[model samples]
Target: MTSLPPALLRPLLCTVVLSTPLLANAQEQRPGVQAGITFGATTGAYAHYDDKPLVLPALSWQGKRFFASPGSLGMNLYKADGLRLSAVATPYTLRFKTDDVNDPQLRRLHSRQMSAMVGINADYSADWGAVAASVKREVSGHGGGVESSLHYSYPIQAGRFTWVPRVGVVHSSARLLDYYYGISDEEALRSGLAAYKPGSATSPSLQIAVSTPLGTKWRATGVVANQWFGDAVEDSPMARRSSQTSAFISLMRAF
Candidate 1:
């Protein structure tokens, strides 16, 4: 199959995932809007990627229970109460200013360009926490990949804080894994690094978070998560042994 550039990929995935909404109980509350900020850092075993802090603003709207956003847009349509359908688009691009170490074994990797992606999610839940399965497809630019994951979350009360735990597993197609992990023959020659082999991918993750009520209309949450990439996805040319362990605190307001 021919590969697509990252730029074209995002919209392609979005179009494919946005199907006719399965209308059942339109009991979903009227759509609302939300805006917030997130900040956190990640660490891993990869050579080209390492621990870095991310500070980004988040904006989203929920309509009849469906959600969309400018940074990562998505929607959810509920069916029969416990079952739901969803889709998401997430893209990140930034220039690396200096050489960074690829932990465990220190190797220098540099990135000059980046791209975006879109994913599809299917979910089922009870009254407590829910189970969600998702798959991401890279569409437009040179860097593209496919990812699938299963996640579960539940809430608990601790002190004055509302705590939640999240867990999941992720798998990726070769093209998807390689795009992010594959180092090309041309790239190897230019960088003076060995040729890279992009492999199939696997990852499992865990997260714990605490959410606290600030007042009647405002709230805050602190989160920490750990992700482990499988060997198939980790052995690829473009593969980084890097895992993501992150912590972030964010404040939210609802209307």
Candidate 2:
């Protein structure tokens, strides 16, 4: 796969860094827009890849029937009795450049490019917690495949801050996993690594987020997350660890 130029890659990296969804417990979902900046870092899952630092703009909007966030956009198709249905589009962020790898052999492999995903989402909210499920397909001509996820989150009030704990599972189709992690015959020959073909995989993830108001117009949020890879991804020669850890913080002002 051809690597994206630095000009395009930078913006995409920004999207990845700012992809964290806004905690519903943190603020009221009113018709408004927020914009600011975020600073964060990540210990990515790829072999020979160093920890990455992130700085990106934070932007989001919510309305009666429409919503937009850092890397995604959606419109509510149905909403009633605490249940909602929507159509959404987001970006797949498991992308890396050959030059980003430290190992010589890994650097010889082809780069993985990002793709856009489009699909539908169903969400239900209650006093106990919130549950959401979504199914998406790669729509950017990058080895088309489907991905799906289900998640649940509960929010707690701690003093002036709202804390949210979330758990989720994500499933990736064979084609999607192979596009990002598989070592092809040509790549294996060039890098001198054994060729690998991964099947579909499902991974689990956990996350905790906290948010508070900075002032009348400013708000701050921070998050920590961990994701465990399934056998299909962990067994890849390009995998560095069975799990990945990441964190981020943001400050935004409403307009």
Candidate 3:
């Protein structure tokens, strides 16, 4: 019953799903920026508290062997042909909902605030698709949590539109799982829910993204994606749903 990441952070996952600064040519040894606004909605266990019609300003920069986004930053350590190895840092997904929702049950749960995850990434690109693997640990959470993923994507260009279809599997550590899905002993007593602690778990994901030319120096990107929580997460007392899904559209200007 965990939630999809926030709108601004959602694209960060897409980058992780592809494992790099996608859309832009990574091997070109160039520097560029894309800036604009992205509006989107995320639906899942936290849907009641999370904002809909999410509006976030988007900014991303990429160079020969480095890239930075609102939620992540990385530098490539090695590159040959289309293979890359890099180090990266990314933001975490929080579990706390605000007081705006009228559902008292949802609001009583504890909140897992945000953390910065840092680790390494490996990516390989081919004509058919790209494959990537990454492992990161929460630096500030101090829970020694580890998150990792293996992803594959295929990009197709038709007319001025480019479509990327992606699939992946993600593994989250016990610390990460417990932080988001488990109720503490204190919380269980206060909220009248049994305390539960979960170990590591894995989840599968799928997504499709499309980008098309809008006008000179501008283009549009839209994406929809979903993640089905693993049993460890789905079985939590705080969990009321099995999956999280999201969609977003953005207009960008390249510089």
Candidate 4:
């Protein structure tokens, strides 16, 4: 399959993941437009990538059975009380900037690029937390990989703040790993690096999120997550580290 250029890939992913609302999750209270700014950072996975910070807009909309948020979207196809099934879209919006990597060979590598996936998600929600499972495949980048994950989260209330802790495991196919990290024969010849292929990989991740009300019409939120990539991704010649970390904090005003 012909893959899209990085320039074309991003907007396509955003449109699919952030522009549409989900069909279900009736309890979601996305009243009015919420807008904010987020400041965050991620540790690079490939060689030579230094930790970099990102500042971007945060926006979301929620209603009856649908919700659209930056980088994530869902439409509940079916909902019965707290147990719901929905069609979901998620863009793995993360990418690497290779300009400053330590390895000249790896620097010759192409941009890690970006992709979006679509699939179905199932969730069971309660006062405690939620159990969720999903499967999606890369649609925009044509990474030719599919992912499946199972996740669980619990929310703990503390005064004016609510904290949620989540843990999940994601499994990706070999094709996906190769597309993102593998060095092709041509790339090896041009970059003077041995060709390497990392097969399918599974990663386990943990995340924590906190939200607090800011007086009347504003809210503050923060989240950080870490994932340990599987050996298939870690062992790649382009990898500088096996683990990746990301952080975000934002304040939003409801319209």
Candidate 5:
């Protein structure tokens, strides 16, 4: 049997459940709190990892300058025309506990803890598409690394459904990679795997999301995404594949 890491639950729940309200607010621009339940699952990319189930209650709030959503909380510092800037704090979730792995060797490795990340985000929307960029640094002493990303997305409307397709690339600092994917000398001896210290890496990803209104106050949304690992991450003994795929679906009602 595969063990479910407690650390994995919070991040997954926040990412899938709380994010629903943000999506709904973006489309409707309504000002109030939204609440709902979400259910989803993910197939991890790590070696000997099993599918993890996600079920949780979610809450989101958007105000004139402050906003709270799944995985993040921020205050808008600048907004005009089609450009907006914000200072945000979020949880960094690319980590795992040893018991979460099914492989005997991997189970001997030390666990990685989740951390808090503080960052700034800038987004611009135009008639053609939207672009978003962010730079965040781990501040909880878990990794003490920096991460940044750039993304582009375009939304299309088909009758009652809205489709959004996005492409993005994420850059992880060497410290982040090492903390999460690297094998220490002691770990190598215990797990009988070669020691590895990886450098910085860049990963690219693609996603498609669809949403429709279920009623006047309710909305349903779904997302599918695939992210390819960088060479450094793919080389890790704990990694079984070159990419990871995840999906999420949720229904939310605004108050």
Candidate 6:
């Protein structure tokens, strides 16, 4: 072999010694971030806030099956055997404005109260499907209330693409529904509009999601969801206000 320079050999030895530990450290700390966009029918422009079809950005972190996002910024623990525990937070509103159903001269009323929520969710999952139930207590806002929901998700895969269909029902107590969607007498007069009453509401919703792997570490996803209401509740006044259905498409990536 040609004579090797001692200077080159010394650096080679150092690199070999250092790289092994660095590689081990990297493997131990499997930290990663995933960012993407999402569109939902009822959630509006801010996929998390609007009650209408909207396109919004999404980001998440997943470490050894523990996943989190800004929309679900709380901690979650899960097991493969169909058990999950989660804590999440989201923004909510109470009063909003709307056009009357043929009544003239009355402008929209506004309460304009904003708030946040902290709640827990429990779910059971399996290869065939998943059922999730949650009870969330309002942490802050004009009036406190409770929210409960039950949902199911089923998955189908073809080649590199996966399709998931979900269905769910939600029920909110009077305090919860009114607190987020009901306007008060004072707010009505102030906004130069008619005041409305508060009551309970229920929604039954369905959604479909199609996702395909973009590469070894990325994926693209699309979704469309629709929600129909029960007589107990009024739809969100701030959004497209639909007892009718809506749809949207989106793209997403994960690592």
What's the ranking of the predictions by TM-score, best on top? 2, 5, 3, 4, 1, 6
Stretches of candidate 5 above 4 Å error?
Answer: 1-29
- What TM value does model 2 have? 0.91
In order, how many clashes per candidate? 30, 0, 0, 8, 0, 8
lDDT of 4 by residue, 130-199 (tens): 9988888888865768889888888788999888788989898988778788888988998999898888
**lDDT value for model 5:** 0.78
Report the number of backbone clashes for model 4. Answer: 8
**Candidate 2 regions with alpha-carbon error over 4 angstroms:** 1-29
Residue lDDT tens for model 1, 1-255: 877655444333322122101000011122476556555444433445434444545454677656665345676655567787776765532222223433322233344334456777677778777787877777777556666778787767788787777787777777765555556677676656666766676778787777777786566667676777787655644444546455666555667
Off by over 4 Å in 4: 1-29, 96-102
The lDDT values for all models are: 0.55, 0.82, 0.71, 0.71, 0.78, 0.53
Per-residue error (Å), model 2, residue 115 = 0.7
lDDT over C-alpha atoms for residue 12 of model 1: 32
Candidate 4 lDDT score relative to the true structure: 0.71
lDDT of each residue in 1-255, candidate 6, tens digit only:
675465343332222221221111111112477666554442321101323233445566666655555344556665456686877675542223232212232244433344566788787778878787878877775568887888888878788777778888888778876654555778666655445555777788776767776776666665555667655444333333445443444444546
What TM-score, over all chains together, does every model reach? 0.72, 0.91, 0.84, 0.83, 0.90, 0.68
Which is the better candidate, 2 or 5, if ranked by lDDT? 2
Better of 2 and 6 by lDDT: 2
Estimate candidate 3's alpha-carbon lDDT, on a 0 to 1 scale.
0.71
True lDDT of residue 223, candidate 1: 67
Please write out the lDDT profile of model 5 over residues 166-217, one tens digit for every residue.
8999999999888888999999999999999998999998888888899888
